[model samples]
Target: MSPSTPQRPRTSRRTLLTALAATPLLSALGTGTARATAAGDVYASNTDLYTRLPDGEGTDYARRYRRHEMADASTEARFPFHRTTVLAPHGGGIEAGTSELCLAIAGYHPATLERAQADGPVHDYWMFEGIRNADNRELHVTSRHCDDRVALALAAGSLNVLSLHGCTAAQAGAPASRPEAVVVGGRNTDFRRHLHEELRAAGFRTVDGAEVPDLGGDDPDNICNRTLLGKGGQLELTTELRQGMFGSFTRQGRAKSTNDTFRRFTAACRAAITRLEAGPDQAVL
Candidate 1:
């Protein structure tokens, strides 16, 4: 994977938010109990998953009425958004840490589009963006299947995308005791490696995406790289790392300042971006 050039100039954070506010949001609903659960993992089985919405109407209601998706969509079309776009597709009870990580990178701003679900039935949900993860629990669309609103953000002029995710250590053959390691992937090797180094400096263990068969991020067709720049990064953090970052072993706490480890991790992300910005022109792959 190589670094790709931005299709447009770097815009201010305010400008980016304005654009993101204009992007359209598609509608959906439903709830399915998760069969899997790990410490710090987010699954819809808990009652708290749907508690945030007005009247407890589930994730769809919040996305439709509370999130102001229509305004986000329309404004997003007006200008090139952030040069670096962060995403957390499995948040709000699917995968913890991811939404928080995206939010951290974006400085608590609405520069990210995180999936909010109390119940969205899905199969192989991680493989695609637009595919519904709720209702009937039948379809599993990959990036090859179709682009969702999140996927369409690439076309809105974001130069890069960084998708955050959480995974079980056992899934990667890692020991339960030390699950603080991370796996970095995506098409932008330079940026990916930079992130890897930064995380290492922050005292967390790391593995290149290529070294992990199950969590490799190099696949071009992977949802991570389906951005406007055609190159992006994906980070798969172990539950241990995520737990420390979120200051909770479950999806119950807020991302407060007390999460020192999480702050360090996000600092590394910002440092990586600064270093990359100083480098030579990236080729738009």
Candidate 2:
């Protein structure tokens, strides 16, 4: 709980995707001392969350359109177009099944060419998770609440990345947007010296966010570090045993850590699921 805690300011994208569509992603990866207070979290506020970011291949077709609203006791009813979008990455390669206009709410999921390797000379540090909502499942950002939001997508040069974007802090989550740290220098200095030697082989004696200005640093392996990292939920993610070979991945306290800031976000979740598998076949207006 250092790095000058108490964050949540530079936020938008509809309040960090509506707090990552109403938080979940494994309780924002929180644990152990609340995961070091979510690695020094932060995120102000504004609320944009984006709505239109289209490209090519159109097939728009879906209808069930309806409208109605009424609130009392004070008033808080506003639903013209709920606007939804889970995780949308792209770079070609995503058309398993889609196309029927689904940005009006949100729909798309295609990312399975994953990779993970590390035994003795480990250094790839992989953690890709780009899941989204299929056509706004009853809004409020559902998917059983975004599987508790967990992000980590990095793989530049050939492209296809994801990372640290679970969003929260509307009330009590943390890191509202992303980027509080992750600024290693020199043309990718070997992917930031292999992420600081994979956290010094995972012990975390002390890494310091670029010398510690506010507590947060370089996390981009590529893909222009996408936005909407969790709000004030802080940070989390860990797995250590090796003592008894519980899950063994190269013992020595097998560590991989984060608090906030680590983006690439799988090219916007494969360009919003290849634009909904290509577009045109949806009907629910």
Candidate 3:
């Protein structure tokens, strides 16, 4: 995808306590039972997956997160609270490239594992990565069914949640000639528009997720929309799009060998988040 000029178009809060209260701590619920499946996922939820998988820094699967905080008293006094949280519910082998993208979008260099800029803004991030040699897809828990306690808590505390996901070109209804595309969705219409504008301006093809109901992150119960503002934004990147962003598609390769495409995509996402932050606080209607 090459950069092109696109026509520009003009583009949540509240019930924080209610969302926090309504979200159950799935980790605390030790029921090993599986729920009825609409997605045919192997596990019922992140909590259920935890029961069957090994979780550690270097295990079959891992959960990682970083919540930015004030550097000092003066910084705390001057800086507004970070209101966005980036999420990758199906990262690593499950949805290759998302883990790295999550890190990059959260203001970190995937290769160096450092802040992208010396004084750049870093938003909160949460990732569930599958590191198994095979069958990693079994770790997947659909967005609507994602009940990871940490993921939920981070999202519920923030005014915005930007989730990264992966899908096939066919799933996105993109033609083979232009398979490298993204579907932007979610309940946060303003944030969604910002993403579309910035991504299109950056030359990436974007499809309206509304055209694909399953890919649309509009469900209020969807984890992405379970934020303080009760809405969030989601990006469903095509496999071709994600593969082109890295020199190699393996887990290690993705982190260590991201290309210009990767950087551009992350930059566009960060830009959209910046636009969202600059806007007035949303009311919890």
Q: Give the per-residue lDDT of model 2 (tens digit) for 41-113.
A: 1212101111111211222111111111323444665332111122212100111011111111122111211
| C-alpha lDDT score of every prediction, in listed order | 0.50, 0.22, 0.79
Off by over 4 Å in 1: 1-57, 60-81, 109-146, 249-252, 282-285
Model 3 vs truth, CA RMSD: 13.5
lDDT at 222, model 3:
86
lDDT of 3 at 210: 92
- Give the C-alpha miss distance for residue 138 in model 2, angstroms: 35
Q: Please provide TM-scores, in order, for all candidate models, with all chains considered together.
A: 0.59, 0.17, 0.82
Cα RMSD (angstroms) for every candidate in the order listed: 15.7, 22.1, 13.5
User: lDDT, candidate 1, residue 82?
Assistant: 35
Q: Which segments of candidate 2 are over 4 A away from where they belong?
A: 1-125, 128-154, 171-273, 276-285
From the highest lDDT down, the ranking of the candidates is: 3, 1, 2
Candidate 3: count the clashes: 2
lDDT of 3 at 11: 10
Task: Give the winner by TM-score: 1 or 3.
Answer: 3
Enumerate clash totals for all models, in the order shown: 21, 65, 2
Identify the leading candidate in terms of lDDT.
3
Q: Encode model 3's per-residue lDDT on 237-274: one tens digit a residue.
A: 98889889989787767799899999999999999999
Error (Å) of candidate 1 at residue 221 is 2.0
In model 1, the number of clashes is 21
